[model samples]
Target: MDLIGHVRCFVAVAEERHFGRAAARLGMAQPPLSQRMQRLERELGVRLFDRSSRQVTITRSGALLLEEARALLDRSEEFLACATRIKDGQSGLLRAALPSGLARETVAAILADLHQHHPSVELELEELSTTDQLARLASHDLEVGLIHHPCDVAGLELGPVLRCELGVLLPRASLLAARDEVPLASLTGLGLVLFPRADAPAVYDDLLTTCARNGYTPDSLRHGQGDSFVHGLILSVNAVAFSPPDRGTAAGSPSSEVVWRPLAGAPLAWRYSVAWPHGRKDTAIHAFADAVPRALWNTAAVSTDPPPRPLHLRPASEYWL
Candidate 1:
């Protein structure tokens, strides 16, 4: 019934103490403003003002309700402002996921950046594998995710892709560790410690194919995502794992127990990007996607300069050779 509008008119008239001045302040004609005041008084069954030929005087009821009416208008404005912020994605819950195996620092940076840009968006962040993230995205359980490449992206939209070049992680005592850059073929006899195939089967397969093509084929392949677990495998099982250069520095190996060396020619790299359900992206999703590259670059030294290349699978018939 435009109850708020009536209250606004009443307050203006009470404050101005004249219908013509109140109408001027409200940017409305005096007649309509008078009618609004009349309607409000009729609805409330109370005289809001005493009109005289020279002036208008606010009644006791009108004086008492003036303060309350002002407060109500203020509250209404605040409510609408809050709604606008939510619609703009500046306030609300944003559900997102990241793959496991990222360094803690990298994760922290991502959270910090998002908070800096959108302090009111409560980030419900989770650590999930690419496969699991895709599942959640499809079900509407997740709004955005930082996912590894080469998986199914049939119904998803992707952000800018970054590639982090991989280097060999081996025991310090290994002969290959002494070289500034280790050739992939130099580690022919060592077992490979890799993330579980179930986590990202396509990437896993692509990595193996690249290794084979580069003249290195691990004698055995073992799966582990955790740094400690991969390190343990490297020491106990005579294996090597590939990781970004920053992982070695972050790990801070003592007494030179383990070392990371760049792979000759930088033949292997892990590609990553932010993903969201197709046609479902919003301001929050874009904000999160923008934050990802900055955090990865700051904490993990991931390269965002390279042009994105889609993951191409080798022919199954030729992959085995």
Candidate 2:
């Protein structure tokens, strides 16, 4: 109730020690300041100043209230300063969701750049499947997403950041292992390890459609949910699977036991894009999104063709054990 008004009047009067001077300091007429002080005293049921013919002095209650009032004012100023920083985008929190398929190195590069350049911006990351990412974005649970493209969600904007060719993972000794690239049709009857079609139907469908457009249906031998598990299956079994080239790192170390080959005739490679609500623009979010591709594009040095066969293949024994 009239706290700001009372605090203003009290501060002015205490500093000036004279009604006329206080009115001038407050840039107001004397009568209104005097009235405001009177109203404040009446509301608090306590007289705050003592008046005499020659001077005005602070009462005991007035001294105590003045101390509290100064503290309140200091706190109010601090609050406003923080609010201004947030409004100006000099500082704030960013909530983002990223797809599990995103490369760890790619994320690390972006985060490192952000940490160095935007010390005031705090970031929080959530790993969500592409479908879940879309849902979270639509519900406003996430501010942005790093996702695979062709997200046709209404009211969502998608901007391509990286276009990665799909590569097949196979045991080094597999028949197709010596090839630099293979057509999807070549894997027609091979055991395929794939992401579970049911859990993330959209990604599964995209993969299937890509294969179908090449005139073949991928034969699924085992289905896993996330990249980790799927990669684990590739390492443990003699199975072959298709994934982005960066996924080679999932093997733990470059391996002689496993190899990756670009998928020839694969209809449109995967495109990773940044997705956000169409009209929700945020500077820090945009900055981070823009930095991602620039950070990742040339860092890995992965080739469109598989690397030349290992000059000296370690004995399979080394990997088997």
Candidate 3:
């Protein structure tokens, strides 16, 4: 009775909950699978399963053991794969999704480094909204995501990689264009362009609350799905909006038709994070997460700022243009 064989049988039975199904999955006879389990119980001096005529269930000990077993198996596989890759002198692929708000050139710079250093490794990039990034990560559609903070999605973990202050984006010819920055209160009477609730409910709510605290409700002229669309709306109308500070390109080329002024009176800032499924303990995920901040460091525009204080503590000077 190999110890590893018994461990596999135990995990199979725990997951399938039926000896016959577990044996089928393991490509063995039911009697041998049952014997393996019984031998395991004898060795451990505990019953791992509760079997009735109608159904089979795992005992409390079995449930706990299952977690440890799975972790052990995952590590073993990872070790073998890493060894194989190193022997072959080849790495694997990293699939990632990113939110549009992150500076595009910053992402490009990171990808360039990965490509140059590990030519054998491949990266697949997708442009998704923050909400889409969250959903895809949970469903395993993406291994890692670059996203905004304040995500409430279950079964996901986040770490802040970079922070940017939100600034007002207005048309150059708009009445608010003369100032370097405008306070939230000054925009109370103005129509605003905001992200659609479906695409970014958290951002939308934050904007609403920020305005409400300033004693005004913004009149939304349109709701957009992404920054490109939002910029389009700004160009077409007198509507104003807020965005991260790295809104310009790497060369600091400003938008000709638009003027971005720091938001006055308690500035609002957004934290961009590296997010993945909580259950995912893959090497690739860890590598990508570790690489993100370093990648940002390679590009000077992206900075890791301390989390901003509560909207109230932010002074008018912080929002200066």
What's the CA error at residue 242 for candidate 1, in Å? 1.5
The C-alpha lDDT values of all candidates are 0.85, 0.69, 0.70
TM-score of 2: 0.77
The sequence of per-residue lDDT tens digits that candidate 2 reaches over residues 2-61 is 787678788879877898999998899988888999998888898999988677798988
How far off is residue 65 in model 1, in Å?
2.1
Clashes in predicted model 2? 0
True lDDT of residue 290, candidate 1: 91
lDDT of 1 by residue, 1-321 (tens): 599888888888888998999999999999998888888889989898999988999998888888999999999889899888778777788899999877788898998998888788888999999999999999999999998877788889988788888998989888887799999989998889988878887888888888888988888888888888888889999999999887887443666578898999999988899999998747788899999989998888777634444444434322342
User: Candidate 3, overall lDDT?
Assistant: 0.70
RMSD after CA superposition, every candidate: 3.0, 9.0, 14.7
Which 10-residue window of candidate 3 scores lowest in summed lDDT? 312-321
Query: What residue runs in model 3 are displaced by over 4 Å at the alpha carbon?
Result: 1-83, 86-90, 225-229, 248-255, 297-321
Local error of candidate 2 at residue 267 (angstroms): 4.8
Clashes of each: 0, 0, 0
Each prediction's TM-score versus the true structure: 0.85, 0.77, 0.61
Give a tens-digit lDDT track for model 3, residues 167-191. Answer: 7887777777788668777776566
